[model samples]
Target chain A: MLKIDCKDKHFSEIGKTIRESKDKEIVIDNCLGHRYIASGVGGKDIVINGTPGNALGSYLDGCKIVVNGSAQDAVGDTMNDGIIIIHGNSGDATGYAMRGGKIFIKGDAGYRAGIHMKAYKDKFPVLVIGGKAGSFLGEYQAGGIILVLGVNTDSKTNVGYFTGNGMHGGKIILRSDELPDLPPQIISRKANAEDLQEIEKYVQEYCSYFGGEPKDIMEKSFYVLTADSANPYKQLYTSL
Target chain B: MAINYIYPVYEVVRNASRCVNCKICEKQCANGVHKFDAKNGIMIADESKCVNCHRCVATCPTRALKIVKSDNTYRENANWSAESMKEIYKQAESGGVLLSSMGNPQPLPVYWDKIVINAAQVTNPSVDPLREPMETTVFLGSKPDEIVRDKDGKIVDNMTSQLKLSTPIMFSAMSYGSISYNAHASLAKAAEKLGIFYNTGEGGLHEDFYRYGKNTIVQVASGRFGVYKDYLEAGACIEIKVGQGAKPGIGGHLPGTKIVGDISKTRMIPVGSDAISPAPHHDIYSIEDLRQLVYSLKEATGYKKPIAVKVGAVHNVSAVASGIARSGADIIVIDGFRGGTGATPTRIRDNVGIPIELALASVDKRLRDEGIRGNVSLVVGGSIRNSADVIKAIALGADACYIATAALMAMGCHLCRSCHLGKCNWGIATQVPELVQRLDPEEGCDRLVNLVNAWTHEIKEMMGGMGINSIEALKGNRLMLRGVGLNEKELEILGIKHAGE
Candidate 1:
């Protein structure tokens, strides 16, 4: 257990120092509004205590970032392979455009959560939100699996309006029985046994990380799946 | 013989008496509507092929041509015109795709021609370019908020990165795979000669063109293709391509067929696989994330080269520009929806994003209001058609203009817009061995040089006409422009008054 006190040092200095150090289990305490913490780190376990600024663990190849407090926007943005555990609320665009990683958030998220998340071959990105998400969730999502578990009962909807807008590819699993008010372009259907099977591992992982029973999370009544049509979008202005 | 009862709905009348044998109209016509019949000792006209671009009418030396709608009606149904019926019949007969270029050339009310340029009459003395030294040279980089001086009260060396241009024009990014090697060489050579810059669009720089590094703006896109330590350090500046004008929300895709030996090696992609750049730079999500990449590139290159982020002009572009202004980017390159692309899904290309004029105006206004205009310089592009458009763009508030499709046209692009087919007969767009050979780099370079030189002269003349000498003085001086036949909304968006009124 290596604990580094980041009381007043800037994000750049602290990040540079941590990156150079060979410590595997590191805890950064009192990290207030510092950006790019644990960015581009490979093969390390970084535990951040305080509220970190934007771009937390960007381009993270292989690392585990556990943010004990809330995080600003763009958490785990474009991270290749990593496990991001956010114990508190997250700002807009959380896990945005993530390629290959697992971001498990235990709190609510701002707008555009998991927008543009994509997958390549065997490497698939998975984002699990334990709370409600803002608008434009999974927008233009080419690939990846996004699961939003509506744990908070205060909000009327699990995801806001225009959810899955311009979503060409990818599977979005919502634990709520009520279907999210999506755009006209996206087609939604009840998740079958095969769909639940595909996301079973992710749900299991989320449960293990957040200390919840996987069976309780999977016991939800229905799952909504949204995807764009095969020959989606016409050439409106120009001749195809 | 089956008699085709196709009536000419529009007659292209050419006055033989006023016609001159100069053939400027014939040369400029991309639709091949006009032809010079040497055996007949006259120019012939083919009205059937004409889409009525008016290039011939506009460029006719003797003003010998006019296009008129004929009363040859097929039916009284105004909903379906004779032209529309002909178009459907043509599509049915050909079983091929429809192609068009330059923009939605439909009568969408071009706001540019409506706006007018103002002149200095008596209040402000218009400096003459012929007499005084006019400064068109623009430095595109982050301007310091406040100059930090040393103890001696002399200027300190704490300035941010910037790109210096001899003129306010830059050759915009057209990738090696998108265009031929000869075309790229031509642009590189011309940029070197003219003291401007040419961009290496996400496809990494070719080793042969490294000698022209001084005038190169290397791009780093989503896929990080061709991005290495050496590639980053090669160019004068680095541009992070988030989006392009042609396809605002979509990524670029160079078909597998075009990715050859050098392109494949440069892009770091396997041969015969589509070089697809993901829509978003996977590493970037927020403004702060964008800053990391910006700083990363800066740190990678030892902060020697200025970093630019290119994005399409979308709604809320002003807010986006403000974000980019604070994103540690030295320069912000905003591409309008009217910009050209090598290959984009036809739908995405045409229907995405706002026009350059509106975007530029709003961005400039917003930055100025925020007092962060000094943080980054504006580089506007997409469809800068002529010297007049360049002048208008600068006045609308771009520090510099990027000309790609126009530059290619100057180097002899027929605007066939068949670049996706990769069989460009003009050698500007295609990578085919035989087709590529058609364009000589030296000649193409010369033509580009000639085009820029001509535009420079025209710019000077327009400036002179406005009684303004330097381009620096012309930048953001919207008083020089007035909108004609424009509504209040259009005029307000353009930041100009009605032309005559």
Candidate 2:
């Protein structure tokens, strides 16, 4: 256990030192508004005891970053392949435009969660939010799987307004019976047998990461599955 | 029933006595209105083909030609006029939308024409171009904040890389798909010949044209179409197109109709599918994110090529430019609202961004005030009409100017503004087989070479008239320019003065 107290050091500097260090198990204490912490790391186990700033684990290749506190906007942005476990709530644009990787948030995510998240062949990205999300949850999402589980017992609606706008491809699973007020471009339905089969691995991974029973969450009831319309962007711009 | 006869609606008359047979008017008339018939003793006029561009009237040596509306009559129906009915019938038959090009040429106020330039007489000493070497060559790159040297008394490290050019003029990006192959060839050849650079608009570079890589500025837009390692490494510079002047808030859509064999292969998309470039880059959400992309591309290319960020000249452009300058961009290209495009929504095209003049002035002033002007170079474009406009642009603090419409005009565009129809009679804008064949690359390149050469001489003459020798000396030299009929706000925004006041 290597513990480093980042009292007054800039987040970038501390992150650089941590990344350069050969230590596998590292703990960063008193982390206050430090940006790009544990960014672009290859293989390391980083635990943040305090609040980290924006762009946490950006372009992370193969690292496991666990944040004890909430993070700022653009957490795990464009990360290729990594695992980010946020214990608390996150700011807006969480997992934004992520290409590949898995991000597991124990708490809620802000607006535009997984916006434009994409995946190529053999590289599928997964983002699971334990609590509710704000508006425009998956705007312009081209590929990948995004699941929002309203584990916080206070609310039932896991996602907010205009969800899945301009979504051309991909699947979104919401652990809520109430259908979200979505745009006209997206088609929403109860999780069918086929949809459940597809998300089985992702749900199992989410359960494994958060130490929750996958059967308990799955047996409770319906999941809202959203996909883009056949002609999602047909009339979005102009008549001509 | 006998058909009602109507005389000609308009007559294009030519006075043979005043005609000098120089053919300047004939050459200038791109609409094929006037042509010399070898079989006949006099020049022949075609009335139906005339769009009344007045090029003949402007270029006639003896003012020999005149245009008049003929006193012809049709069944006077205000809503269902003969022309309107014909247009409706054509649309009903073809089932196609109407498309136009260039600037809004329908009697709209051209701010460029309204604005005028000033000269130095007795009050300020304009340097003599004949005696002194006027510095027209501009280095577009980041400048050093503080020089660092080693103990050996030699300069060790500089701040930013510079793009050196012989003249303060560049060919703006016109993608391969948007224009014909011959047009791209002509532009590429001309840029190589003139020692300037031409931009390969977001379309990927063809394999054959890679030899002109030194003279090309490859563009990367949201779609990331044709963006490969080689494409990034193939150019002298790379431009990240955020938004265009013609349609600021909209993305690019190459209709399925234009997606031919080579274009489909180059764009890496299926044929008959619309090539959609999203409005915003999926990776960039803020200025810091934009910085990341800039650096990422730099890293991908090993920092050898200069990276340019091209944005529309919108309101608050100064602040936007300030952000871009600090965002590690090497060059900031501010495209004015009047820039040309192959296709754009008419509503957004006309109403989206600010004029180039005001945007350039504001951006230049903002960067200079921050003392970070050396951090990035500024290139302004929208509608640079002539050499005079180029001189004025540089004096207003632009490192260079970009000319697309002017270049098209040199290649025989009639300014009909019907490029979207893809049936350009002049062969300058269309990609149709027949229309494309009209423009020969060799001849087109020669004409472009001739146009720029003429403009270079005229630029030198203009500099000489101001007694300034080089373009560098003329940069931000607003005192050499004065505004005519411009208000205080216009003068302040343009950073110039009223003529002779």
Candidate 3:
């Protein structure tokens, strides 16, 4: 393991150092809001301490990023394959356009968490937020699974208004009996045993990282939200 | 149905004297316009279904068929034209937004026609392009701000990555789902042969065309479809599509029906899922946010490939372009309102954006005024009709010109203006198997090469006439352009003088 002190280092210097380093396992300490840390870097395990800035693991291909402190916006932006474990909360668009990855945030996430998330053949992106999420949580989500556990929230819903607006595919599982005000295009239903069974792996993994009881979290009432139709604009236009 | 208010816009004129009863027209039309009546031993036409694409007229063995616009009159109302009334009737019946294809076909003023190129007459000797060396190759990207010298007293080469084009013309963005596979193949092949880049639009690059990675500009729109690690690094440059010229503020929704097989696989979405690219990149709200996305892409590609930001030419395009120049973008592409699309709302397509000529002039002037023109390169598109337009764009401060509608015409599009119907007999826009096979990629590529080669010759002639031997000398040389019958405000905005002056 190669430990490096990121004190008073420029973002580009930090990036170039990590890219040129031969070390397989690297640790970054004293990080202070340095954006794009470990961006598009794969084939290694990176552990970051202190607050990491926006786009923490953007385009991260087959790497593991462990953040000891909170992360800013666009944490896993357009990431193809990776595992990001954030011990604290994350800002807006935490998993924006992530195609294939697992982003586990111990605390809450800001707005547009899983916006435009999609899935390919064997790559299914999973984003699990321990606490509540902001508005437009799954806006325009095409595929992938988003789980909001509402770990310490007293609110009635785990997500905010306009959740799953224009969503065409994938599932948004929330640990709450009452649902938020959703757009007309989305359809929500109570998660049955099968639905819960499907997310068991993600839930167990989330608990193991954040120190929670997976059984207790899985036994709670949950609701699933999905788009009514993949073809939302079939009747929206008249050919001329 | 309430007396059938709509009427056929075209009339099929089949010459009875030249008719051989070959049934060729009936076999060529994809809109089912021509029907063979075996008992009657003749061909009947459904004028209502005729898009007037000229496919049958061009394919007829003999000169036996022609389509003419019907002289249908509706009281000759100047305020409400026939097209406007028909559009009203269509909306009343379907209750949906009107969709159109191709560029804006309105009788708007084309600035390219108003501007004239200046040639050396008396003082400066005109060099013949055939005799003298005329360079048309252009490099698009930011040049180094200042030269740095090393301790060894050697000048360090600080030039960033650039896209080198043999000519100032390039094929514009046209996605695979919106067009056919053969069309993409033709464009990829033609781009390779011409040493110019062809854009993948927002549809993502097909696996087959990946071989042309050196000449491909992979696009990353709001949807980010088919955008993964490999896709981002596959192209020579990456374009972040903010808005399209056809529909400035609206998002693009490729209907689920068009998503199938290769398109689905290439875009990495489900077979029937609608590929929706929202108006705004949700993550990008400000110029600072745009810088983040730009840097993120740079990081993804290891700062090897240049990043371009494309936006529609609107009322305040100069300001928007200025902001983009400062946002770390290597290139700024401004698409005019007359740009073509497979589908767009008719009203938005016709009324949303400004002309390319005016937009290019103003953006170039503004960037130069800010003293940051070297920070990024400018590539303008919307409707580059010919080589003259390309020359005018370069003189108006554009680094290069992107052509889509003209490129499609070179590939055998008849401008039927019915690409939204997905029954294009020319095989340029449709996705059906039989219809797609009609456009042979080899023939299409050859034609495209011929078109660009022809345009390059004309460009060289125009440059030689202006006493310029290279595209670099022609860049932002507005003094060589003169406006005819243009008002003071128009001339001022275009940064050109009157023809007499």
Best by lDDT: 3
Candidate 2 on A1-240: residue-level lDDT in tens? 678888989654676577568888889999888777766565788899989887787656678888998987778775667799988888887877666788998889989888867665555678889888888888867668899888855666678888888675667888886777777767777888987776667668777867788887776555665564423434433222
Q: Candidate 3 lDDT, tens digit per residue, B269-324?
A: 88988998888998899999999999888877778999999999999999999999
- Local error of candidate 2 at residue B356 (angstroms): 1.9
Docking class of 3: high
Model 3, C-alpha of B229: deviation from truth (Å): 1.1
Please list the residue runs of candidate 1 whose C-alpha ends up more than 4 Å from where it truly belongs after superposition.
Answer: A1-7, A12-240, B1-102, B121-125, B150-154, B282-288
Which structure among the candidates has the greatest DockQ? Answer: 3
Candidate 1 total steric clashes: 11
* Cα lDDT of model 1 by residue, B1-501, tens digit: 123345655577889999977887676654466889999889887876565545577668789998887777777577786656765665565454444334433344455666677776787676677766667788999988887888999988788777888888899988888888999999999999999999999888999998999999999887566665567778999999998888887776565567678887766555655555767875577897788788656544556889999999999889999999999898999998888887675545657788889999999999999999999999999888888888998998899999998898887776656566565666777777766876899999999888888888778878887877778888898888888777899778877777765
Docking class of 1: incorrect
lDDT of 1 at B305: 86
In candidate 1 the C-alpha lDDT for residue B276 amounts to 55
Model 3 CA deviation exceeding 4 Å by range: none
Which candidate tops TM-score? 3
Ranking by TM-score: 3, 2, 1
